[model samples]
Target: MGIYSISDLAELTGVKTHTLRVWEKRYGLLTPQRTDTNIRYYLDSDLKGTHAGVKTLQQRGTNFQDSRNDCGRDGGGM
Candidate 1:
């Protein structure tokens, strides 16, 4: 079980820390645990899902229509 801070996840995934926070809040992508000090941290599975989700969201780019077009062309390429 890996533990990662927001900075770590951002560094690892190249998804800006602010963007990660937005995905967490706006899309419920990554569910981080908070320390008593309120610092957010993530588990391995959380990071894994967030990593995958970021890839998908980057490709989708806030538009399901574009995503569907890609899917139609590529059979839901991942």
Candidate 2:
């Protein structure tokens, strides 16, 4: 159970930090934990949702909302 920073997740997932933030804000793709300082941190489970892979997390459609709809609650394809 490793905790990861946004940069770490971006590096591991090959997605930019900006995009990761957008996804979290727009799509509810990630559920990062907040520290007392209000800093966001990710977990190994965040990197890999239930059964969804890293590639799945990186897949985005024209608009994030649409992609999110397709990528069910677990961020896996419907």
Candidate 3:
């Protein structure tokens, strides 16, 4: 149950922090936990899930925004 910060996720997943924030707000694809200090944190499961979702959508010929929206609608990957 490793908890990762946005920067950690960005480094591990190769997704920009800004883009990830957009996905969270716009698509609601990921729901990260918040610390008492108002810092965002993601669990390992969340990271893996998001990674799979992004890859699946990319393979389906969807751009980032479209993929994010589609994941929201499709429950984030197949």
Candidate 4:
């Protein structure tokens, strides 16, 4: 399994690194593994799950611009 840094994940998911950190802390959407040095890293499944959640919310009428903001404010995941 490959692990990705925050920047890599943001690039892969089209979400900002700050937003990703917010999601990680607030929504519990991602559970990145910690390296021996305590650096955070995510697996491919994390990206896939985040993408799936984004798609689901889009289908539910949550615009991309608003979804992350809403999620951050509401503390809701998925």
Candidate 5:
């Protein structure tokens, strides 16, 4: 288990940093934790969640525009 910054997630997942932020802010896809200094960070779970969401989307043959709906919605999406 490790803590990851948004940039780390973007690099590992091939998603842009801005896109991740957008997903977090607009779609509630990621739920990052805050440090005592109020810095945002993610855990291994977030990375796994993203991968699961992507796989779910692919398996369902969901189009890019409609895929967000099926994403776990409770802060568990790509």
Candidate 6:
């Protein structure tokens, strides 16, 4: 039940903020919550939806370093 900003999501999920915005607009990837000050924040569930390995790591209590490998950033298909 953690809260994260777009930049935080970008770092954790390895997805750029611009791409995230596109996904949100085109694919409905995330439904972000806004604060009283109108700051966007995302829940932990959103992070999991962005990547399967993130969900698995949370379930297994593993660190996030390995999750990056699952994101197909290393010349693999996502």
Candidate 2 steric clashes: 0
> Model 4: runs farther than 4 Å from truth?
68-78
The 0-to-1 C-alpha lDDT of every candidate, in the order given, reads 0.71, 0.67, 0.77, 0.77, 0.75, 0.71
How do the predictions measure up, each by TM-score? 0.69, 0.65, 0.74, 0.76, 0.69, 0.63
Off by over 4 Å in 1: 57-78
**Candidate 2 residues 19-66, lDDT tens each?**
677667767768799999999999988888622644453463234345
Q: Write the per-residue lDDT of candidate 5 for residues 1-78, one digit (tens) a residue.
A: 899998898888766677677677977789999999987899999999877876776798874456545554432223
Q: Relative to the unseen true structure, what is the C-alpha lDDT of residue 70 in candidate 5, on a scale of 0 to 100?
A: 55
Cα error of candidate 3 at position 77, Å: 20
Query: Which numbered prediction scores highest in TM-score against the true structure?
Result: 4
Q: TM-score of predicted model 4?
A: 0.76
* RMSD of each predicted structure: 7.5, 6.5, 5.2, 3.7, 4.6, 7.3
Q: Write the per-residue lDDT of candidate 6 for residues 12-32, one digit (tens) a residue.
A: 987678767756765576888
Native-referenced Cα lDDT, model 5: 0.75
Name the Cα RMSD for model 3. Answer: 5.2
Where is model 3 poorest over a 10-residue stretch in terms of lDDT? 69-78
lDDT of model 1 at residue 27?
58
Clashing pairs in 2: none
lDDT digits (tens) for residues 1-78 of candidate 3: 899999999888877888778768866768999999989999998799778966876788876666547556432222
Segments of candidate 6 deviating more than 4 angstroms? 53-78
Candidate number that wins on lDDT, 4 or 6: 4
Total clashing residue pairs per candidate? 0, 0, 0, 0, 0, 0
